[model samples]
Target: MSTGLGRGAGRRFGSGWISGVLAVTCGALGYGGVLCLLFPSWLTTPSARALYPLELVRFLIYVMLVLGFGLGALSVVLRRRKVLGFTGIALATAGTLLGGSSAEIGTLGGTTAVGLDWFLLNLFILALLFVPLERVIPRLPEQAIFRPGWTTDLMHFAMSHLLVQVTVVLTMLPAGVLFRWATQPWLQDAVAAQPLALQFLEIVLVADFTQYWVHRAFHRVPWLWRLHAIHHSSETMDWLAGSRLHLLDIVVTRGLSFVPLYVLGFAPPAVYAYLVFVSFLAVFIHANVRFDLGPLDWLLATPRFHHWHHAANPVDKNFAVHLPWIDRLFGTAYLPAGRWPEVYGISGSPVPQGYWRQLAWPFLR
Candidate 1:
């Protein structure tokens, strides 16, 4: 099952692709800078301050601008990628002119946190780390780095990252309103009194148990299936493929998961730790690399575990996203000895191509 477009065949690194990638990178940085400059209070992440001071982030942005220009110059010198070079320079120049990387936050107070800062930082870091990993140790060696529908998936990634505030607001909206009445201080305190490791373990168990049923519903229920099917429509599974989720799907599933955590009243640190772990694990399970964790595959969901969920032949199996045991308990588990799906995607996908159309699809009926 080798697609000639695999990593071996993708090394040509077409000039057009190079230019397009560079252009997007430069544009995102410039766009992020403008957002920070104009709405600094609303476009920064709260976690960023704990990770690094504002001054350091600003300094790094400046360094990225310098590198952007240098790359642009190298592109032009090579003559093969002049368009990428020039466009990158132009965007980088615009960003510099607008004080995009400037540390000064005049009168904005820089308080209301957004996802732009997190988005850019994560974008750079994830690409730097994962792209090479996928290429070098690909599960499907024949799978290309730039597989079909990559652009659509990329848009999904950008939207989810850039609209972090909106996601948080919508997901937590139910928690804010319902938890106010449902929360039992005693229950919360009891749960929080457990050891840190126990708290973390319990959080995973509770969250994934709820998510397991919610995830299954997305496949069993017709309307919800319409939204979730979009997630499973990717013909090529990779890190970016996990990002191709419908916004409504994200809100509903994530919102559902939040209910238990809030009602149970897990400590703030435990809750935050769970969120961070889920974020990384989500990408890990959907990654293109081959990592069959021998015995752990039965315990934790791996790429193969998730790939089976997305398999066209047996679409309704393996609904558990993190823990494999949930499926085992519910009788939906379908790992057949030692086998991987020959192909991945929806069986008869009617989903449209672009992001907007797919988003509007669920309500069309």
Candidate 2:
């Protein structure tokens, strides 16, 4: 209810900034939802399509559109930047005009597609979860959601999500061929005989062990570092920063990480559980929230622990993704009690400015 002006470069927070942001987010997602309905094969993800109920999705889209328009109106009345509200309002209105949730389905099938649905779904979920978390328990209170290079990070996020199909294929192809002979039926049964919980733990250990070396290789190998540097290039560490990884980096690391799991014949369910856990863990370590885990910080990697790895000069401290023990064993662990990095990113800032530029940067050099 406070309509007071905000400080720090005259940015207005109380005067409808929150409403405008929410409106734009909801409006954009709602518009995308309509497009998915109209072209499910080309725009929607198979995982979401198979799992989500159509009626429920339509209802959600309808709700988002209504809220986007209504909140945009409210933001327009209370904010100086009418563009924010108008943009939100326009998106919602356009979705509605294009038939919104009632958009007719095309005859085209799912023979070919990208992950637009995945991007929208993930963006909504990640933002919904992390935005409030950072605001409430922030490592840097002064840090704004839309910080410098945020747009670049966001573009990276969108591109990665949209290419989920490609990444998945590339990751699994070599893995399947290399590990097929080793996926013996008896071995699979023996591995699967273990309790699901135990299997998941093994998956975590295997994944972390494999990723440790792969991650280290990225830093040590100059050519690989060129690609991996795009991830380190993010000057500001946040949840989105983790999503700034180069596509080749994602594919190669993931491909090798899967090698151990696939060769060992872990149950698919356990593998899935580890995948979900790693997804969250990756984002959590890069987040703007810091936790004092006491001695437990040595047992697992935390934001403070990982942030030091992103420090300006020596950006090769922590190498383990989950277990910091790997780093300690390898002599790369660096953690000063109750301290975070004062600065992040590379010293000379060799990485380019834009997403497209950075995509080609590693190759150019």
Candidate 3:
């Protein structure tokens, strides 16, 4: 019976219809768990409590993020049933935001810390889930929008976000140690007395500028490109594809961007708010949804705008993340009048076969 089951599995592996049904079913179950189990507990938690409410809300948010990502993975694997995968993602995302807001998990110290932990936990879970899925699914067709090979992309995204969380935690150590060593009485008092809006703006400007340079460096440098290249190697751009970044690249880039915000005496409140806003945009820009931001694209980075940066041709453009003014100032902005790239990914380099190989290849190459 075991041998027969194994043979049956082998036969079913090659059938797109069978795999598509399985993918949609898995996504439905996973997403249903979040809506039915996690959302209510989080929403009903008391807002007056300090840690409990924050913790509950954070957990729910993480569950939603994980579910949305899982649905995205299933979408690619079960290409024939694209609508089911997309609907699952939409439902999970709505549930996550609703649950998070319902708990009133404001960007305070306790809530901020809990949110970071939630992000990291979700990444770990997603990475573990995708490893076996990659082995089971066959490679997708060249021109196909949903690639069965997307398990690698999901793993990359998970690892990158996890690394960013680690970097943020590490930043606290230096901030604490430096405060202990220097003991700046006046600066400490000033920071404590600073207005939240002013402090928030200061943090935003400093972080934006720091990230601007870090993003530019990724394009300029060679060794760094090896790791960063994973993000651009996706033949089909989707929500999961956005997660396909090298862990090392994430650590360095996010660390550099985060450290300045810490050192600049930005209020912790401001940092928390800024991180949430930026994190949402990062995913939004990488998402595969077809929405054109006509005039708004010039003011801020959009999917259509950022997608050009990942294009194989016209390599020298769109390096800035939030503000395009920096790119325009540096003469690196490359968006043409009402046009889009036909192809994306590394033009000549061999695409990595799997997540583990992609992770190791940066060092080995």
lDDT by residue for model 2 (8-120), tens: 11346657777888889999999998888888789877766778787888888998899889999988888877877888899999999999887787665645477888888
lDDT of 2 at 290: 64
Question: By lDDT, who's the top model here?
Answer: 2
Best by TM-score: 2
Q: Candidate 1: lDDT over CA atoms? A: 0.78
Residues 1-365, candidate 1, lDDT per residue (tens digit)? 23235432222454334544565475557556655655656877665535757676676667667756776765666544356677777777777777767736644564565577777777777776778888888888877767888889988988888788788889998888877898888988998888877888888998899899899888889999999988988889998899999998999999998899889888888888988889888988888988888877879999889889989897689988889988999898888766889889976667888788878888897
Better of 2 and 3 by lDDT: 2
Give the Cα-based TM-score of candidate 3 against the true structure.
Answer: 0.62
lDDT of 1 at 244: 95
Which parts of model 3 are misplaced by more than 4 Å?
A: 1-145, 160-165, 171-195
lDDT of 1 at 130: 76
lDDT of each: 0.78, 0.87, 0.59
